[model samples]
Target chain A: MRRSERLVAMTDYFKENPYTHISLPFFVKWFGAAKSSISEDLDIIDAMFEQLGIGRLQTSAGAAGGVRYIPDYDMELSKEKIDEIIELLEDPQRILPGGYVYMSDLLGDLKQLRIIGKMFGAAFKAYDVDYVVTVATKGIPLAYAVADVLRVPVVIIRRDPKVTEGSTVSINYVSGSSRKIQTMVLSKRSIKENSNVILLDDFMKAGGTIHGMVSLMNEFNATVKGIGVLAEAEDDEEDRRVDDYISLLKFQEVNEREGRIQVARGNYFE
Target chain B: MRRSERLVAMTDYFKENPYTHISLPFFVKWFGAAKSSISEDLDIIDAMFEQLGIGRLQTSAGAAGGVRYIPDYDMELSKEKIDEIIELLEDPQRILPGGYVYMSDLLGDLKQLRIIGKMFGAAFKAYDVDYVVTVATKGIPLAYAVADVLRVPVVIIRRDPKVTEGSTVSINYVSGSSRKIQTMVLSKRSIKENSNVILLDDFMKAGGTIHGMVSLMNEFNATVKGIGVLAEAEDDEEDRRVDDYISLLKFQEVNEREGRIQVARGNYFE
Candidate 1:
């Protein structure tokens, strides 16, 4: 194949399989190109990727190593994405009854979800996340998005147990906002023992659900490497149950009567 | 940028934003390259994409015309993916106590989900789908996957209404397998009136959940253009409530006592 065609093919492969190690011989065989030619093509793609501020192709030495795509969205680009999200959130029409912001529409947008996932993936890129864990309903998409970028599996915690999950581990915790006890269940085979995980959620208020997730991770002996939320609402500091996490957007205020909403970049920017 | 670098960036763009039209001038301005150079670069990438059996870049002429990536996974490659899934599903170890197959692991796999999504996307590519819809929980990821490939937003129906959803439209439907009536809810704003949507689910037994979804879509006056499921199981033909849907895999049988499982490609292959 010519250099241009090889570049297109290689770029597609790297994008499709992020963080997966591909040996040099495999590429040479697949592309029917010389080792030197493949190496040059890698360098070109790598340079272009970095120049675009998405990420770079990390290459390793020796027989067992080749190259892998480490996807990263720089702070500047991530800021732009966050700003776009903030703009969407600031629309007064999104304000629901009882000061709740209607964000199902935003969460439903695949393009926006991909950006949010990439940003969270960038935030936790340094952590070796074995699985992206989230509670079902809304958080499922965010977890899958982050897993997509990190090339990891997503473990979803369900509100109720189902026959299809086989045996499961269940936990009950008080929801911070509602102060209601809720049960979260996960299949016994979902996560390996002592694995590292990143907890993600679509929204956070008083950190009840996130706190619950952290407690559930303890059951599997998994370490919570990081936590991320798409948006965090302001709550009493004394009511907060969890800390040491990242968020992309913050809800400073939402007044239903006034038809007003105030949103800003989350603490992750700080 | 040079043609080589342009190919890398353009390929990334098309992969990220499939089914979204982009004018040629937008590419020219974004790349700081001449119009002809951008056009030539698109041609190179399009040809390579087709040659790779992924999809092709479609272009239109005249005013308000542009190019878009129509992602299509051909039948041969799709069969290979289905076979891989079948190998995993056929493992007897996956049988649960009630003869249910454990598939959360496969569903959690992003690579597998992406492949499944692409296969479904290809199957419904000709349909002018406005939104990809699914019931919440397990099907959320699959819905997002299809939406990602189709470049459309996802609409998730919930089991119960939440405050964050604002006002909702709900319906009661009998679950075919369980023979119990269940409530399915969608936010009033989730889908616009008279929209076209595709229904996706992770698994189907008697198609109760999907049937419930179709009923909910009716409340929004949205048309169900297509239905796709990752897997379907053998059931009494008289008991099945849903037909005319596409599935990737079929659960021929699961014998708990014998620890045997049989899986085959879905009707989509036929």
Candidate 2:
């Protein structure tokens, strides 16, 4: 195959299997090219991805050695996307009663969330997380997206136990917003023993949900590698509780009187 | 950028934004190349993709003309993966008491599901689908995988209504396995009016859950472009009601006396 064609094929292969490794010999055999030629093609593809600030190609050496494509994003891309997302959320049309913002549109927008997933996946690309964990319903989308980019399975923890999942492990942590006792459960088989887990959610107020996720991970003998949220409330005066987390946008105080909303910077954009 | 680099960049760009179109000017600016040069680069990328059987590059002419990378799969690759999946599913260890299989492993394997999603997404890539629809909870992973490859949002339908999705449109349908009246609900805002949708699920016993999704789509003035299931029970002598659906494998029968199981060929491998 021609060099350009090889590069296109290689990139497509990597994109389809993010955070997965492909042996050099396998590619060499598939493309009917020399190992040297395959290596050169990968270098070109890797340079293109690095130049665009979107992905990375990591090479491992050994009997199981292979090239793995890691989906990543520039810090600026996160900032721009977060700004666009925050603007959409802060729109007056989205403001529902009781100072809540209607986020169904955002939730249903797979495009925006895909970008967020790629960004968040980039943040934890090196963590080697075994599973992506999230609470049911709203957090499912975010978890699914991150899992897609990271090539990891997502396990849903129900706020209440359903008959479908069989026996479950339950945890109770204080609700971040209401300070009430909120419970969550995971299927006993959903997580493996001694696994590394990444906690993800759609929103955070008092960081209680993440705390619960941390506790839940401990129960399963899994370690909490990282935490991520779509949005974090700005009133987190006691911000020392959150571990390593990246939020797309930090929620600013809502102006009920003037109907104004403010958002500045967050870890995702930086 | 050079022609080779432009091809790599374009492929990466399309992989990131599956269903969206990019204007000519956008690529021209990104590559710092003239419109004519960018046009040639796209043609090279398109032909390379077709040759590899990885995907297709669609181009349109005139004012809104641009390029789109429609996800596709090689037939041989599809067949190989399906065989592996069937072998895994057919293992006697997977057979649970009550005729149910322990599907958590298959559902939880991100690499396997990613390939499955691409194959399923390829089917509906020709159709203009805005969302992937399915009932919870096993169906969530299938719907999510399809949505990931198609780069579209997924709207989950629930068996019960009172859980957190707010106001919903409910429909009564017969679940094939249970043969009972079960209600499914879609969040009012989850789907837009007059949209095209793809229905997907992990397994189909009686096609009851898919019928529920079809009913929900009809209620929203939308259309069901395609239907797909990861596995189907062909020995299900009960009345089958679904049409135009694809399955990876069909369970023919379980010969408990002989310690054997039967599986039928599926169209996805073809």
Candidate 3:
């Protein structure tokens, strides 16, 4: 293959497998290029990535060393994206009965999910997260999106156990809204012992769901590294069970009868 | 930026946004390059993609015309991956009580999901699938994965209604296993009327769950374009409620008492 062709293929591979290593020899074998030539190509790729602010190539110079793509998300771009989404959410039509925002639209957009996922990944990227955990339904997509960006497994806590999953570990915790005891379960084989986990959800109220996730993580001897949500109920921050978390938007005063909704960019910037 | 640098960045953008169009002017503005220069860069990228079999860069030549990245996956790589995973599933340790195969590992692995998602996307990419639909719990991740590849939204069917999702359309279908009546639902706004959707899942038994999803889609006035499953039980194929679906792997038998498991690549290759 020619130099430009090899570069395109290499760029695709590196973008797909971020924070992962690819030795010079593997590139040499895959592209049938010389080590020195591959090194020069890497320089070109790294420079482009640096200019784009999409990611960076961390190259180590030794036999055991290789190049890694570390996603270097632009905070300004993220803020703009989040601001745009927040504006979309502020519409009165988005406010449903009982103060619920129509979150499915945001959850259902691929472009939005990519930005939200990367934003979450950027916030908790420093931690050693073995699993991105969330409950079933709405939170599953958010959890998977974060996992996609972080390149980790997503452990979903189902509301009810299914026969297909085999043995599981179940727990009961208070719902943030209802304050009623709710049971969530994870398969016994889903997570490994002593793993680091990051909890992500679509929305947070009193944070009882997140608290339950923390308890569920303990069942497998896992530690909670961080907590992040796409949106948080700004009204009940004082009543939340979990602190030290991140959110992209703060939803407050969502009164359907009044046709009123307040949406602001979350603490992701702060 | 130079043509070479633009080629690399364009490749990354195309890979990230598959089956989406990028107008020439957007590239022109983003790169601060001339229209002719951007055109030349796209040509180089398209040539490279054509040679690599990763995807194709389709160019349109009019005012509304632009370039699109259509991923043309290599089947040999996909077959090898499917065969390799089949070997892993054949491991006796993956077999669980009542002949249930432990699937969380595959569902959890980011790399595996990428391959599986891409594999499913390749099969249904030609279809005009507006939404990738799946029932809650295990199928959520798979649905999101395929949606990622196809650049579409995922509509999840919840077993029960949540106020957070707003108003929902519900349907009842008989569970293929227990033959018990069960209900599944989707939010009214998640999918539009007459949308084309593909039903995706982690596993298929009597096809009852997928059957439930098809019925749920009907309530939205949406059409079920196709159905794809990661694995299907061969023993119950004749007993399935739905026909005309694709599966990547076949679960023939799982005798936990004797610790014997049988697995084969599904109809995906054929």
Estimate, for each residue in A1-270, the C-alpha lDDT of model 1 and write its tens digit.
899999999999999999999999999998899999999999999999999889999999997889999999989998888898898888999988788888887888989989888989888889988999999888988888899999899999999999889999999999998899999999999999999999999988899999999999999999999999888887544678887889888888888888989988999999
A58-78 per-residue lDDT for model 2 (tens digits): 998888889998888887777
Docking class of 2: medium
Candidate 1 stretches greater than 4 Å from native: none
Q: What share of the true interface contacts does candidate 1 keep?
A: 0.93
Assign candidate 1 its CAPRI class. Answer: high
Q: What is the lDDT of residue A203 in candidate 1?
A: 86
Clashes of each: 0, 0, 0
lDDT of 2 at B109: 76
TM-score of chain A of each: 0.98, 0.92, 0.97
- TM-score of chain B, candidates 1 onward in order: 0.97, 0.90, 0.96
Evaluation by TM-score, superior candidate among 1 and 2: 1
Model 2, stretches more than 4 Å misplaced?
A60-65, A160-167, A172-183, A236-244, A254-264, B159-166, B172-176, B179-181, B254-263, B267-270
lDDT of 3 by residue, A1-270 (tens): 778777888898887798788888999999888998999889899999877767688899877978988876778888888889978888898887877788787787788898888888888878978889888778878888888888988887888888767788999998987879999988888888999989888888899999999988888999999999889889898888999899999987798888988988899888
- TM-scores of the models, in the order given: 0.98, 0.89, 0.97
Would you list the rank order by TM-score, best first? 1, 3, 2
Per-model RMSD to reference: 1.1, 3.0, 1.5
Residue-wise C-alpha lDDT for candidate 1, range B1-270, written one tens digit per residue: 788889999999999989999999899899899988888888899899999889999999888878999999978999998998899889899999988888899889999989998999899999999999988788888888899999889988889999889999999999888899899988899888999999999888888898888888888889999999888886644578898899888888888999999998999998
